[model samples]
Target: MKAVVTLIFLGLISIALCAVSIGDYSDKNHPGKCNIDGRILPPGIHQSPTECERISCGDNGFAERASCGKKMIRNCIPGELVDKTKDYPQCCLRYFNCNGEIVKA
Candidate 1:
C-alpha cells in the first residue's frame, strides 16, 4: 500500500511539472495572446521605437490590430501568411514578421 501511494504521488508530481512547463512555454511564446485549446497562438505585440502595441487573436485564428499610434495604421493577416511588405501601403501595417516578431510595414 505504501509503495502504491508513493508511485501515485510521483506520477502526480510529474504531471504537475509537465503542466507548469507547458504553461511557461506558452506564456513566453505568446505574451498577450489568449489561451485556447488546440488553437495556435498569434504573434507577439509590436514594439516600436516609441511605443508598443498588440494584436487581437480571434477564435478562428485570425489576427487583428488592437492598438496603434495617432499616425500609425494597423493591419491584420493570418498568422500562417507571409508578411507582404510590398503589397501593403507605406503607412504602418502591423503583421507577424518572418522571425515571428510583430512588426510594422
Candidate 2:
C-alpha cells in the first residue's frame, strides 16, 4: 500500500509538470507576434494601400475590433516604411516570458 501511494504521488507530479510546460498554439486567439498600426508604426511602413488601411483602422477603433491586432499594436507605431515596400518593424520581438530574458523566435 505504501509503495502504491508513493507511485501515484510521483505520477501526479509528473503529469502536473507536463501540463504546466505544454501550451496551446493551435488557437488563432493565442498570443503571438506584434502588430504595429496607425500612429505607432515605426519608420519604413509598407507601401500597400491595404496595409495603410489596416494601420488607419487603428484610429477608427479597429484596434478594439481584433484582440490579437489590438494586442500587437497596443504599443506599436503607425508609419510609412523607408521604401513603402520593405518589411515593417517587428514589435513582438522585444517581448519575453515572465523572466527578464528574451525569448528566441
Candidate 3:
C-alpha cells in the first residue's frame, strides 16, 4: 500500500506542474480587489472553478493558485477509487482500490 501510494504521489507531480493556473485579475481599476473570469474576489484564498485548485486573493486582486497537477494514464488495473472529500492537498490525496472496493479505510 505504501509503495502504491508513493507511486501515485510521484505520478501526480508530473501532472500537477503543467496545470498550475496563476490568478489573473482584470480589475486593475480597483486595487485590492480581483475580478477573475468575471468573478469578483475579495482578499482571501478561494477554490478555483475546477475545484482541483486553491486560489488566493490579495490587495492586487489576483488570486494565488495551489495546483494539484493532473492525472496521467496508468498501467495499473484501476478499481473503485479511494477518495475523500476534503480540501486542496487532502483532496489530491487519492488512490485506487484495485483488489476490492474500500467502503472506508
Candidate 4:
C-alpha cells in the first residue's frame, strides 16, 4: 500500500517536471531543449572572419538565419560544424560562437 502510493506520487512529479518548457536553444554540446511537445534544436552558426560571409548550411543561409525565431545569430567567425546529427546539412554552425549565451526565443 505504502509503496503504491509512493510510486504514484513519484510518477506525478515526473510528469510535471517533464511538462516544463525550455523553448528552442541548442549548440555543439547541448544539441536541443525540451519543450511542451518534445525536444527542439535551434539553428547553428557558421563562423566567418572575412568581410563576405559564406554560410554553408542550406538554401543560401536563409533557413539557418530564420531559425531561433526572434533570436539573431552573431559572433560566428571562422566557425565550423561540430555536430552533424542535429545541426548538420540543415542547421547553422559554431553555435557556441554567438555574441552571447544561447537563449531560447
Per-prediction TM-score to the true structure, in the order listed: 0.20, 0.20, 0.51, 0.20
For model 4, what is the alpha-carbon lDDT of residue 78?
32
lDDT of 1 by residue, 3-100 (tens): 99999998775444321111221343556454434344554433222223233454343454322233322343323223323221222334444445
Model 4, residue pairs in steric clash: 44-92, 44-93, 45-93, 47-76, 47-77, 47-78, 47-79, 48-77, 48-78
Residue-by-residue lDDT tens digits, candidate 3, 13-72:
655553555656748666688786667778888775545566678877656767555443
Clashes of each: 0, 12, 2, 9
lDDT of 1: 0.39
Looking at model 2, residue 44 earns an lDDT score of: 27
Alpha-carbon RMSD, each predicted model: 19.1, 17.6, 7.3, 17.0
Pairs with backbone N, CA or C atoms under 3 Å apart (clashes), candidate 3: 15-70, 16-69
**Ranking of predictions according to lDDT:** 3, 1, 4, 2
Q: Candidate 4 lDDT, tens digit per residue, 6-95?
A: 999987754443212122333334434222122232344443232112222322222222221112345533344334334322333334
| Deviation in Å, model 1, residue 81 alpha carbon | 28
Better of 2 and 4 by lDDT: 4
| Residue 49 CA displacement from its true place in model 2, Å | 42
Winning candidate number (TM-score):
3
